[model samples]
Target: MKADPKNVLVGSHYLDGNHACAEGAIAAGCKFFGGYPITPSTEIAERVSRRFPLVGGVFVQMEDELASMGAILGAAWGGVKSMTCTSGPGFSLMMENFGLGIMLETPCVLVNVQRGGPSTGLPTLPGQADMMQARWGSHGDYEVIALAPDSPQESFELVIHAFNLSEKYRMPVLVMTDECVGHMTEKVIIPPAEEIELVERNYTDKKPGEAWPYEDTKNLLSPLLPVGKGYKFHVTGLTHDQRGYPIINDEAQEWNVRRLIDKVTKNVDDIVWLEEKDVEGAEIVVMAYGITSRVVQPAIAKAKKDGIKIGMIKMVTVWPFPEKRVKELADKVKALIMVEMNYGQVFLEMDRCVAGKCQTYFVGHAGGTVHNPEDVYKTIKEAVK
Candidate 1:
């Protein structure tokens, strides 16, 4: 529930982080939510499942993670904006078909409220352990747009952005949250429907002509028509040509894969987004995102007040890794302190991008809870010298 600022009581009341995320999806015009109830992220599904029925939308709790993901994809193909949520193990189970969604160019959202894990590690705790897995878990070199939010309000806003980006790009966008933000209670202000900008999938008819399912357009993302719209086209996991037919030749495989990859890579500038703290003249910079970034913020403010030239970069979108902006930041800063809750996962990516330009270090811990602000401060002080 969110307080509507328009009349001071127009929209729903202030919802928790999980419910705020559900409301964001609904605000973004999501008509279908298919997912299983897993710890930490279960509230999201429960809330959506309960709310959807009232809005004339569909909510189906699938048998497992695999089926949950599959159902979301199917729903998307049926011209419905859809989503699914889960934890680490469930996310792992969904990856095989996650790649399938990539190949099919399905427009949907996957919300993984990550908990501790290698396998059922900690269901009731906060962890950014799956940041790397969010990008690489599905296997193959494909594009994944992962967003990390530091608060309930952000969890609400980012989910809408996730849906917009997914529809605009025609790819599966992941709104990756953690147990801290998912379970934390906060006053989330939901914007009115008129204020929220929504982007629907493009389905146009060029009049009285056969709509090309996979026409040769300059933009790699072609128009998507529906199943019963009398368009003869194919969708498969194998290599597909422009017309959606399977092409077993080397050149065809190269063309399709290259196009899919290039569609995202070429548009990295538009997709890669972040927020920066005081960066100029900073000797030490701490780079963190998601719930962990919130933990490190107070440390940064204290450092700034103490006249320590410490800066920060709070990344909102993780992949295409924000490589160019990160490289620029690395060149200017003396040291980069990457604070994640994993065993050097996304930290490795930061290292690769900032190599030879500046010093890079990691502040990571994983079990149940996250590192505190004082811990991040200690590392920032150590790395400053």
Candidate 2:
């Protein structure tokens, strides 16, 4: 489907990532935004609050992050596209409900403009520390799709993609951007509505009593029935049957969880996105995402200038970990380097996937700032030795 002509800005402009994200959400047909103002990410809410009313959408500044998450979920079930934005502490608060969104198979977007934190570590600084938390924070067995954008341009673009994925798969999708990208100002070209593609909600074709809420389909995805549509269906966060009633049995648990996991794992090829450069015959490859991908370029340039056969992989989709591509590269390259603004969170996944096929190295930072290119260059020089 095409974006609504009423919502798209339809011109080039200099915008920060947060504002661009807000514009993207509006263009993607998101009608409800429930969020609390958090540093770096607050601009997104501010922009949405002002723009939503003009486009016949609703923007609510909820009491807190927990309420913010709950409101979005409720809005989604009520037949509206919804989202919320937060930073580290707020993201932590949203975890339990985030799990609920997964269990209910709610299609919504969560934008985390990350800041350094175990708890309130660096409220206003850049950090990529939430990469692992996005995958595992909610607890229990479930799969999620997460995207990392390096600049304002991608911040605008990927949020739209995130929404498309969420609607197509019937699951919550995440845009794991950081303070650097959220605050960075850059030129973003917003295209006209006709050129921007969107994925509409896959509502069920069956009438109220004809279809079950959690009916098993061949594709492992069931269509959603909007609330207030006289649909007589139930949905709960517990292990549920096809009728959406809680059933506490080993069989039911296995059946319920496996579908949630398989829906994503089985379709990884279609969900994952990566940008690779000079990888064909390179001796070593540097892997990075978000702002770190941009941070490593000078190092890569230096390595190439020294006649080192270096390649790069920019992880556009951070979760589901791109296991196949990493394994293939592990076989071809002498070494793989994982770079991020945190100390070895995602690098652990890269190492596990490499699994002794090739050497794995981590260029990690403690999160107030991005990596120093010289340090990365030194690591690149050392990896070849």
Name the TM-score of candidate 1: 0.94
Q: Which tens-of-lDDT digit does each residue in 1-385 have in candidate 1?
A: 2322331212546667788788888777788988888898999998888777767689898999999999999999988889999999999999988888988888899998989998989999988888878888886777788998888889888998998889888889998889988988888876565677778687746532466555656877777877766675678888888767888999988888887788889889888888887877889888888888888889888877877898888889877788887798888888988998888988999999998799998889874897888888888777776
| CA RMSD per model (angstroms) | 2.9, 0.7
Report, for every candidate in turn, its global Cα lDDT versus the true structure.
0.83, 0.94
Stretch of 10 with least lDDT, candidate 1: 1-10
Candidate 2 has what TM-score?
0.99
Candidate 2 ranges with C-alpha deviation above 4 Å = none
Provide the TM-score for each candidate, comma-separated: 0.94, 0.99
Clashing pairs in 2: none
Kindly list the per-residue Cα lDDT of model 2 for residues 219-274, writing each as its tens digit.
88899988888887899999999899999999999999998999999999999999
RMSD of 2: 0.7
In candidate 1 the C-alpha lDDT for residue 98 amounts to 85
lDDT of 1 at 298: 90
